[model samples]
Target: MKRNSRLSLALHALSHMAFNTDQPHTSADIAAHAGTNPVVVRRVLGKLREAGLLTSERGHSGGWRLARAPRDITLADVYLALEESLVASPSETEQDMCSVEHALAIRVSTIMNDVEASLIERLSRTTIADVRHAAQ
Candidate 1:
């Protein structure tokens, strides 16, 4: 299934902030590291900030910083902050469907819901700190 890239994008931006506690990172700087645009970085991290996971500053020498410690932020937190799902079922189509097709959609939706729940459970188990450690 096609997944939204925002989750990974947010995680990447957060990792940069986590590693550089001594200094806040500019959107331009993170954009460079993430290989994306500054606006994209801003938009993604903007969600993180709204979720209380990070903070943003304005003016010269201003940038982005974590609101709390890396250990305090989970993958689930970042994922949810982006408001995207890991397992996405197909969108409902307007075309008329047979009874069997309707039944199958129901079953698939149930399974997809379960899969998403499990994925979220697993994501809750790991924090950004864990990811940082693993990356080292």
Candidate 2:
């Protein structure tokens, strides 16, 4: 099971944006730094754009820029932008599964939900600028 890396990629791209240089960072540049393809970079960044965390431009000198200051964009913002499930739960066994199995699954699902909520709360405490500053 390959881990979905959209969350990390979005954060990485946002951190790069915090230190924008001569121009907005292009998808190609970001992909190169990430060691992935531009298409993948675009896919993850697209979500960031949709969430209003970043903005994109198209033209000879067009690229991506932060929609707001990095201080305003929390890690939770990126996580939510990607819309990924932090917890994975297996499907119910068989339709004829015993009551004990059903009960256990319900309890597990409840626990997972709580865990996901806690994760988002923790992420909210940090921002892209925070990470960028720490790196520098």
Per-residue lDDT, model 2, residue 46, is: 92
Candidate achieving the largest TM-score:
2
> Candidate 2, residues 15-129: lDDT per residue as tens digits?
9889873468889999988778999999999988999998899878999999998899999999898988878875877586688888888899899989999999999999988
Per-model CA lDDT versus the true structure: 0.86, 0.87
Q: How accurate is candidate 2 locally (lDDT)?
A: 0.87
* Every model's TM-score: 0.91, 0.91
User: Which stretches of candidate 1 lie above 4 Å from their native place?
Assistant: 1-4, 93-95
lDDT of 1 at 58: 96
- Model 1 lDDT at residue 35: 84
**Per-residue lDDT of candidate 1, residues 20-42 (tens digit):** 78788999998888788899989
Model 1: lowest-lDDT 10 consecutive positions: 1-10
Q: Report clash pairs, candidate 2.
A: none
